[model samples]
Target: MKQDIHPDFKKVVFLDTSTGFKFLSGSTQGSDETIEWEDGNTYPLLKVEISSDSHPFYTGKQKLADAGGRIDKFKKKYNLD
Candidate 1:
């Protein structure tokens, strides 16, 4: 590995703002904020809009919207009994 060629990979805390969910992981991303984790360690805090905890797919609360009317058309074409 080349020295100083890679961004700093360190432990960081990712915060899901919507769900108030937080997790710790290693990343090259840096943050100006800090948070005390459950392990009693301080890590760089990175705030994000969504994560697996709040995401539709992971949470199984996905809303399948038929914006273009294609899905509805397809279902109509098949003719459900």
Candidate 2:
């Protein structure tokens, strides 16, 4: 509850560079760059490498390793099958 000791928290725009997605949210992070949002207002712009839109896990496009095949190969190699 101290005054003048906390970082400024304000609405900022986070840009996902990979998917070109933009969202407005509150953040304490600062940026020199500014962007015009859909609301016709300029806000601080922060560029990010990945976001939910382009992430494999969120989009259900992640490739899971074939553990069953690996186990079979290991069993064959060790003659445990």
Candidate 1 lowest-lDDT run of ten: 62-71
Error of 1 at 70 (Å): 28
Cα lDDT for residue 72, candidate 1: 76
Taking the tens digit of each residue's C-alpha lDDT, what string does model 1 give over 2-79? 788877789999998767899999999998999999999999999987789888989999644444577778888999
TM-score for each predicted model, relative to the true structure: 0.72, 0.70
Give one digit per residue, the lDDT tens place, for model 2 in 1-81.
Answer: 879998889999999876678999999998999999999999999998778877898988863444338778988999997
Which residues of candidate 2, in runs, are more than 4 Å off? Answer: 62-81
Which predicted model would earn the best TM-score? 1
- Give the Cα error of residue 62 in candidate 1, in Å: 4.1
- Residue 11, candidate 1: C-alpha displacement in angstroms: 0.4
